[model samples]
Target: EDDVIWTVLDRVEISDDYTVIFHWKAPFPYGKAMIAISSLINYPYHIYGKWAEKVDPTVPVEEEPNKSLVASLKEFKPPRPITTGPFIFKTATTSELLLVKNPNYWAADTIENWETWFDGVLCRPHMADYNARLNNIMAGEVDLSFITVPKETVDSILTVPGMRFVAPPTASFFDLDFNYDKYPCNILEFRKALAYAIDRRAVQEVAAYYGFPIDKYATGLPKTFEEEWLSPEFLATLETYEYNPQKAEKILRGIGWSRGPDGNWRDAAGKQIKLAITTWGPYQDWVLAADNISHQLTKFGFPTELRPMPPELFYDAWDRGDFHLRVWYVGFWSTLSPWSGYQSTFGWDLTRPESLSWKGRRGLNPKDAVWAAFLVDRLGRAWKPEEQKLIVEKLAELHNKNVPLIPFVQKREYMFQLDGKRVTGWPDPDDPVWDGVTAQGPQCYTTLLVKGILKPVR
Candidate 1:
């Protein structure tokens, strides 16, 4: 009911003791995903509901200090844990956290093969000194490590006996997002030209920890999930881009950007076309990718600046849509929210008019923002599954034509290597059900594998 109230259900009626019926405002077939998230679970209304406040962006920032509805959500921490998971908190310190398996967990007697393998689990504090942690893992002091490493370091680690490496493609990715409000970037021809001029394959090679295999560069949606989500007719209409300098040059010429006396490209208004690419400095891959893009854009006769700042400053600048072109990643898979598919990240098409915010809290206004917003808003309010797909098809068409963001390389990833001396049966890359992504630990497709799946090789 919590999920449906925003878009689908009109009201929930208490039918009987064990049953509650949801009355939909419209006929909605997309409730399966919302239901899977337990969106109808009742919260403690008597205790916390009083703190709820309507958070509207129209409220002035100065006034928000006192008027925030979520101020209590952050300020208040309950006296004890209140969750129905398999673990129970026991003790904690600056250096460690200890938890014991909830032996009296609700399903203990009724569930099959549901006993926890560990009686207790201890987690060490997150270490900032990555080198020290890596060294300890090499010395067998730590059983596993998940921190990302350089290409050379990854190769060296693979040579360590009793340790194995696994790379899984996560939902995250790096991309080049264009700000529609920015000058030349607002032009479709310019955006498409940049897509063709930049050698994405080369950028992937320099940015990737592992060599950039073709499979690793398929950008945009996960091809594995595409067949399930994208309609065949819509998929067929999608436009694809590849590296072609001549095509880029032709497109730029058609858009009225021409070579000037300085031999650099210039707009009709005589301003030398310049682009700025920024990223957080802590992200080494993004810095390299930005630098690589700067060089490519320069070679294509567009002056470009690369700004690599601390994460805080970079994120603030990104949130303001202050750059002509920025290289970053935006995702829909993580949030799984229909509206956010377009409203998040650079928000190239988000716009607010007539007291209505087209996007989310940020109130981002991008020149290309509203058409996608209109379709997405309808998608949320849509009643029928077929109607929702029709809206998605239109959304896909806008995505291909707008070029708000260009997904260059898929975030093909590597894994946490467990010392073979400590554990085994960490499934390899091609075990079918679990590709080392999605599911975690010894569970494959949520089922515990035989021999515990992850056994102690020792």
Candidate 2:
């Protein structure tokens, strides 16, 4: 029922014994490119196929079907695994999951695709406390972590023997999601004013660990996608939200906000309007960015508070829509297209409750014109790139005008520093790897290990 990515279909047609084709209910312009990505089709379904029919619907439907098809995958013990990929899922535990190269792999050593370095791979989940994870790295307990390390420690770590670093604007996007269902913020003029008051460039410099951002601070889409997807007319006509305290104050004044004796703002009722920016912690960059936002807003004569909470409390509060202002990632990953991000963030679909549900955290509703534009874009039946470009341009125009989400950084230039002595030859920027920054180093390592390009230093 949770069909968050709606393009995935329930029905597939087998054209031949070995050939199959997918059928989507709609044109879904991005469907073909994302089908393999957004859905799982490559898994060897025959081995686990037996569980599909075995699932007894008779067992009280209210409770979870006592036995699930997935349960079979879990029952698989160590070493023995039913897989089609180059490696076999070997072992899994609380702290680690291991994968080993398959000797019976279809592409044997004699084949060019069969070349591999490591016989097996071990993966360790980084602890919630980032420092603990870093300590493990320093102590040689963990070989690599693709997550952005403590920014201050990066320089010193780079100087360490056999250590290397790669820092770029990976798919992670940082922005302040406004709760349009809430008060002042719900007002378009007020939101636009807030956008004008804060400077994203300053925030990016302080929050992003990279020496320089890969793209200019964004309004909706990433800088990398701007040339191809964004409409030139939209850029020329849209409000760019450059930092101007005077203009921000002017906009608030037009909205009936008055300056009180305390230099803070008060509504027509004389009640002071305060804004607090809350962000998740355990990552210094998140806190620092929130603090920077707070500082900038304060300069606009708006009182702001920075509440940095632990991830648990932060998410609980976020889900409840309790914060006046929240800064967090808005779901853009390298493997995904921008359209996926826009829909899941603002589309009017009951299946995706987190996007615009009044009771949910994002606080947007179907009233936004952006949702309508997105639907129109999806409706075009033509599959040509020219037709796709026109649709994307329309979507971009509506998105840039509304300012539902303001982004500071969005790119695929993410990198992780690694200890060369432990494992070497990580993927370079030119590598054909499509996966971005992931745990157990970049997903590129997974491919390199199979291709025998990456190796254990010893």
Candidate 3:
């Protein structure tokens, strides 16, 4: 059981062949929203039931099932993919994948005029090369794409005759995360000093041209929900860690730190402070942001280096808490609730041994741990919006006080481009469908395709 679901779910019951019901352990207000966007899939019983039958329900599968049912599941590779959607896998290669429309789709006759306009979808891999993808888009070789275009190139891309750019708000944001177990960063005063020294606006203007600088008093919650869930009076109480190099110098000096003749910060013990910011190399924006931050901190006396690693190595470093500081992406995925954001930030309940081992490795304060547990519990039990708001406010307060993670920018829009000559029914900028087509919303293209809103030009 995943930690997120385990907290709120007691058990699931299959009431009938076509019906399934969930029993919540508490009054989880986000139950419906959670299920709607959950990636949990219903595996075909005929193929998977054989493994399930071997398990002894009385004993834990981890012990009795020596090889472990999970390991077996992981090793079991189906000859082909099985799906119950509008399309079925036709073929795949290193370069491309093809999926043809399902003729016997269950909803074919259920809905009026239900039909897929295109015979199939052909997907090609760009291998994280944005320039190649953009080239394809400009040449009209690609019908649709969700590439991240730099702000300066938007006007040039618009010059393409049949190209259309659709940008919508997303819940995603970039943050600077500190490894709490490491030195210098582990110190609260040092963290605050670094936060004050680094200019978030500079990062936004330089690397995040399409993104907005996070609020000076960010509370772990995305900017979109700040105004909705927090009151003006409560928001005013938070500390705004604005860009102030002088304040940073003062804090470091008060903590018994001094600058060496070489212009590097020396700790009380006379050790020069050297740090590195690790970020994924494939993401151009993240690389630029990390480089910009490293330069700022290096200039501010703490010699910092930008370490750009591949995605796999970067994630491994993050999971193992190996680096001093790193660029992290924080978001609730497809949910707009503050509960998901808080859970992602605080690691839900620290009481859970697994969560403690995985994320609680951050060495959270005991008092903060208690508050986080209370917030998670209270939010789960609060059924009314007003009641949930009160609990969320407290969580935000705690986040504001302790600079657990320094949020840099909030992605306000996602750049999605399409060839208007190939498809005629793309949603306009002001269409209501756009509301459901965000990082925190349903799959927009899938919804449009199923609803017969998009059709190929005849």
Q: What is the lDDT of residue 202 in candidate 2?
A: 81
* Model 1 regions more than 4 Å off: 1-30, 35-71, 79-82, 89-152, 209-220, 226-239, 260-263, 334-393, 432-436, 439-452, 455-458
* TM-score for each candidate, following the candidate numbering: 0.71, 0.79, 0.92
lDDT of each: 0.60, 0.62, 0.76
Q: Where does the lowest 10-residue lDDT sum fall in candidate 3?
A: 355-364
lDDT of 1: 0.60
Put down candidate 1 lDDT per residue, 1-458, tens digits, no spaces. Answer: 12323454565666886777877666555455454432535345455656643444465533764356556466777666654545578998876677777777765554445453545556555533456666766666555555555677777776677666666654445678776656776567787788788888788777765523222222244433344456676676677667888988998788677898777898767788878988877666778888999999988899889998777888888678677777777544423443334434323323335223322312223433555556655775677767766765666566666565666665555555554565556665566544434323222322332335654343
Q: Among these predicted structures, which one has the highest TM-score? A: 3
- Model 2 spans > 4 angstroms off: 1-3, 7-10, 13-17, 41-51, 54-116, 136-143, 149-152, 209-219, 231-234, 309-312, 332-336, 350-382, 411-413, 417-420, 427-443
- Higher-lDDT candidate of 1 and 2: 2
Cα error, residue 445 of model 1, in Å, equals 10
Q: How displaced is residue 215 in candidate 1, in Å?
A: 11
Give per-residue lDDT, candidate 3, residue 256. Answer: 98
Candidate 3 wrong stretches, greater than 4 Å: 65-67, 110-116, 352-363, 439-442
Q: What is the lDDT of residue 295 in candidate 3?
A: 94
Alpha-carbon error at 78 in model 1, in Å? Answer: 3.3
